[model samples]
Target: MRYQIGPDEPVDVAVVSAVSAAEECAPEALPQLTEAVNPDALNEIFAPKDEGPTRRSGTVSFDYSNSRVTIERNEYLTVEPLDVIPTP
Candidate 1:
């Protein structure tokens, strides 16, 4: 599954939504994203900047809701079953 995050949307929100879709469950039913990663820190590293240009390149990947969630700044977000995510 894949999702594109809007410039103003919270990364955590997108993560929850994407992960929920992958898990075939409601967003509210999924485990807290904080259990997988620090939402604040994740957003901070990828968030659009006020003093400089927006970030266009970076990757943050972790396990969430039994899926592999990977975020590409300003590019795309991907979610897949954990087993499919090659060990790296």
Candidate 2:
């Protein structure tokens, strides 16, 4: 599932929203959202720069719970199930 962040919406909030939707549960009922990178830092890094061209391309992916979440430069957030590995 893909979700777009609303204007002024924090990336962290978007992440939780996506996860909740994918799991078919309320955000509060979901497990704590974890990220490999600091979400605040990500927002700052992806923020529109006053100087030079704005970053038009980039992607960040991380594993959260049983899902792999990806946030793209186009403001699209995607959540998908991770591949399950069979134990020997």
**Model number with the top TM-score:** 1
Please give the lDDT score at residue 36 for candidate 2.
49
Q: Tens-digit lDDT track for model 1 on 1-88?
A: 8899876788888898888877889998988888999999988888778887767689988888799888987467999998776786
Q: Deviation in angstroms for 55 in model 1?
A: 1.5
For each candidate in turn, the TM-score is: 0.87, 0.78
* Backbone clash total, candidate 1: 0
True-structure RMSD for candidate 2: 3.1
**lDDT by residue for model 2 (1-88), tens:** 8999877888888888888898788888866765345767767756788999888989988877667888898488899877653336
C-alpha lDDT (0 to 100) for residue 83 of candidate 1 = 75
**Deviation of model 1 at 82, angstroms:** 1.1
lDDT of each: 0.85, 0.78
